[model samples]
Target chain A: MASQPHSLSYVGCNFLRQRLVLSTLSGRPVKIRKIRAKEENPGLRDFEASFIRLIDKVTNGSRIEINQTGTTLYYQPGLLYGGVLEHDCSPHRSIGYYLESLLCLAPFMKHPLRIVLRGVTNDQVDPSVDVLKATALPLLKKFGIDGEGFELKITRRGMPPKGGGEVIFACPVRKVLRPIQSTDPGKIKRIRGTAYSVRVSPQIANRIVDSARSILNKFIPDIYIYTDHMKGTSSGKSPGFGLSLVAETTNGTFLGAELASNPQGQGTAVLPEELGLNCAKLLLEEIYRGGCVDSTNQSLVLLLMTLGQQDVSKVLLGPLSPYTIEFLRHLRSFFQIMFKIETKPSHEELQGGEKVLMTCVGIGFSNLSKTIK
Target chain B: ASESESDRKGIQNAPEKNVDGVEWAESKAVEDEDGGGDVENLLKEEEEYGEENDFSADTAGALKWKEDLTQKAAEAFLRQQQSAPNLRKLVYGTVAEDADEEDDADEELGGLFHVSRPDKESKQKANALDCSKFPVETPQDWDLDEVMNSIRDCFVTGKWEA
Candidate 1:
């Protein structure tokens, strides 16, 4: 691809996905230079290459050029041509890494995106498939992108190192999203979770559920953690166990937290009960960081709000993540939009930490590529 | 001077009292002070120019405008700060420059291989791991009764507003 002088130029390999995503959405070309240029074994890694490949697959006529050492990547973004697609993501990172960008781009596609993603479903790194299914899917529905077609189904659970997971994600395309006003995230009414064990003993799942329930029951009696014991083919190549808990508020807010154990041979063997209790503590920490959306899905909701119809959208979020902060800057560059951010101090006592109120008028970007049927 | 001082106090108390928010307010207030000083110097230069033309120290009406210039700028600064939320500016306003300075320090150290400096805080921050989990910074001791009571209102069983 010939580098256009007007393209937005950035340095380093960090935030490559966001730069590409926003550029694709806004139809602006981007040039990323000095990607791992200073490192001993310089240039883009396999995982990043996989991400770029996935991006190329999902779009139409996107011209991507990387230099001899694969350090510099110049991408001229094409139209979002979404269709039924399947891609095997690199096992270096979890499927969640790829899914995060897809969530941002799926709704604005030409056709509804129905993609089957196969890779590490759960890992210590990145937000797992369960958490995204529990938290991000519901958050998308708030912007009125809901129908029978919208779903994220995990057919197989895979752990890190040797991943063999499979999950199907389908989202309906929308012409224009309704601008949301979600300032109030009401009191959590119930706690729900999935304690999944694959290729491990079935009793381990029970042990996890018992220990997790012991901790969470102190707060709310409406706690129900289901133990999912996948057998045979549904259990992926790697053996692992983990927990994903979601706290549902009275006003339909879902704050989710998940913890996957160490892989089969990564390190010391983890006790299921200990993993369960620690995961419960993580859930408590998430509750303390309570907001309309959880920390993991903060960027997703913000992106949706930015792309919504041209009306004011306000959301109360607890503490912005570093990724979300960078996303905000990228949003400003790509869309020429900035959010009205305010720190909302918690009222009275015991209500967790400081919440950030983000207000922005949506760019009113309609899906021009969507075919009229 | 008194007006500007009081306005500074108001600027301090204008934003919500979080650790980050307070620090941001301080940074902005410092910028405002710098801006105020520059404008005051410009006004002084203008006053000197006027005195060069007409040369009278006792022209009270003319001198008062110069005196009020800083006061007015301070007041305007406070007003604008109060009106628009500065949190957004704090987050995305300025990029950290320490990393750039360090990068320039070793542009061509050995002609072949440039000297690589140790990773500074800003360097690590710029190329930090991209994960969306906002880890608990100051973990609250939930064992204590006082700490437990703080979050009681968050639950249905906790105290509800009337």
Candidate 2:
């Protein structure tokens, strides 16, 4: 179980999750040092500790070690022994922090991954679960990982700082990922979203929906933003309101944006009408940076493409995010795959911005540990 | 007084008059064509680039009027190499070099206690929060006529070109 061909070393803690997730998938050992080594109380923070513990829960035989000062972490990745799991994520960060990595590892697991994550479902820090469900699930389907078991359901709406949100995410395992060619993102046909208000005036949701529709009505008439106001235990521990918008294209592309009210008492109180209008504008910004996959799911799709059956895969993306750029570097270290990057300047008048054309041949990474039914 | 001082500093740093800012801007625009985009150019219309990578290596540079064969061949190879580097080396190769820079922040006080430097932005970045959401650097104003026209074709209500 401890066999490793080569151990890749990285410094700092910025991309700890990406390095660890890629290592676990590739079965490589990773050593990360100087984790806030300069700080007075240097070491991994509580949120990162929670993330490592969550990773430990999803896999078996994994070995993780941290120095006394928590300044260094050594991880020997084990097989993805995925099964039923539950995790209470730290409130310092949102659940989207952990869910991002889970989306990468779940498909290559020995068994289907079924996990109940409890934490802040919607916050300013991460892409909320609603946005992921609206955008990421369809992006995964493009790579042929679809099945009856693939679903992401938010059973309880949670907001920060005292988060009580609960989300159930399940995904089916795949022996080999299918190669994809997603070059053209068609014109948007309709816009759909959910305006969720918890422990707040239900009237607030209507106000959000109306203002958002007012902005979006100029483009398409098929805009429908549902107002969902959860109550009691399902509403979560705090009072909050937020909106998650998804614009669906004719070619089945989903571009998403979301905004959550400042968590109870953290910052300035946001108006429901303003939140809705701003969220709509944000969606337009996403569309301007048009790509087959939205900005948040760029790394996930790229990872899946790298693990696909040794065939060529091509994807057009908007400007690569800083996080995606780092992920690209990490993929080379673990899997020895470098994408052919071509900058595709926007050719059409009034298109959002420049696009990036990424092309690579998959290494044909197969799941050897999954049991055949 | 402070504002005037800064204005003087700005003028001192400005490029000489011989270098036309317009020509420099044009050359910068062409250079940015390699990676970044000029958002203002959306209204100037767009240019199409149809690059055929598969047939280029074998069929390209079939010319008799060219001089310096070695230089041309070298330039072609460099263009191809620039698109995709030695990816594995680019990642792990620089990591080993960066391992040395990590030790510079620890300044020992009196040979026993170590001092932490808050001035290093990299240190803050290394320990920053991990999130996937990429916020827009420059959000286009939706109310502007040109900005609105830029994304009009993305919607169903807009005109579609053949």
Candidate 3:
């Protein structure tokens, strides 16, 4: 590295995680200003601050500065020094929020990242740990980031508000990621799901399973919805129930949908049957969007594709989500990579909605921090 | 459908129509006759029999679209394909970066005036909550058989092509 790259500048608090993660990955400084500056309670939110601390934990000698009012932030990234660690993610946001970024940085670390993230595991907002475990892990495995050490285990169930959930995430560091060319999304062969209830009646889980199965059974006979009811200490501080469904395709693609009950005392209580039915419909909607990669993990797949070996990596995805659109622009800024986006209409009969074929040649981003054997 | 097709062709072959509007129709009819004359001669007996059975009520029935169904669908699909805006341009267009520049210019103006710009929508988007979930907007009514059948082939049990 001859000279430090110029810092990228941005405004506002939205996409703060993406900016920071890309800055760290690209080894470029970043200056973000006017974060909720005009709002009554101005400055960095607790979750954003917690996110910064986690980034600091994974990296060595990184310099981070925030202004007096906390509306401005400046970060100069350091080498990714991953190791065994634990982080208490802000309860304001779910652990999934932090885990999503960590998945991007994990493979490029100096050492394997074995961290325990404790916070809300399942909530109305954000992807749940259950869905990520079922979907994202498989996506990562396709990129050859698999071994006995690659695992995401949820030790406790947590809802929002007063979150007390815990989970362990571990990933192996790789020198470089393999380029992928997955276009064909095979038909869904089986549907597997989990209906989890914590500090709630055990019967709720069964009711959710029965209702969800009733909707999904119309398409396939191989449907299994497991009932997971945690007792005493494992159930987090809140009393809630949720259902997460994943449709497994024949070509190893997983599309997931989930619905969680409102946090205690936050909104009207949700019936298990109603939640199950709605979740099933959401899963159907996902199937309608039909792509090799589902919506929630679209950005992750794109990021991995950008950092792969210097060869063309193509993926068939559903319509680009707004977050992914922003991520694409950020990738252009950080890595100077632009994808060839082509809209593929459903030309065949009854194949669901339109799909986008994304193609990009990787920047050949190798993990320089990984110690050579 | 037939009217729109003729109107489109009429606009494209405007030079021929300049001589006479009726002459333009006669020319199109002659072209059609030249193209279909061979096929019509080969199936003349079956064509006469088909015309004999073509009751007026059948043309007005729900199955009317079945007339030239493949050609009509192909034309409609082509129209849709051509009308769709280029998605690559939409994502990488200067419009988005222009928004950022406009925000910066507004901020500069505010700095001089010592007053904040009240751009509600862009401001809200700048500070919006970040979540990865792409929520289903306007979810289809799954109970409807039509909607259910839309994604029927997505499952393994659906018909498989040999």
Score each candidate by Cα lDDT.
0.82, 0.82, 0.87
Question: What's model 2's overall lDDT?
Answer: 0.82
Off by over 4 Å in 1: A1-5, B1-86, B96-119
Residue B106, model 3: lDDT of: 56
Give the per-residue lDDT digits (tens) of candidate 2, residues B1-162.
555654553353344222333543664456423322322332122111112122223322333222223234334434544654433344334543253466555576778887665646566666676677799988889877788788888887787778
Backbone clashes in model 1, listed as residue pairs: A350-B150, A350-B151
- Give lDDT tens digits, candidate 2, residues A1-373: 4455788876678888999999999888999888877668888989899999988988889999999999989998888988999999998888888999999999988889999999999998899999999999998899888989999999999888888999999999989999999998888999999999999999999999999999889878999888999999998899999999999998999999999999888889999999999999999899888888899999998999999999999999988887888888889888989887777767777777888888999999999888998
- The better candidate by DockQ, 1 or 3, is 3
Model 2 residue B73 lDDT score: 37
True contacts kept of each: 0.55, 0.68, 0.78
Q: On residues A61-111, what C-alpha lDDT tens digit does candidate 1 reach at each position?
A: 999999999889999988898899999999999999999999999998998
DockQ of each: 0.33, 0.32, 0.52
Per-prediction TM-score to the true structure, in the order listed? 0.82, 0.81, 0.85
**Tens-digit lDDT string for candidate 3 (A174-193):** 99999999999999999999
**What docking grade applies to model 2?**
acceptable
Q: Give the DockQ (C-alpha) for candidate 1.
A: 0.33
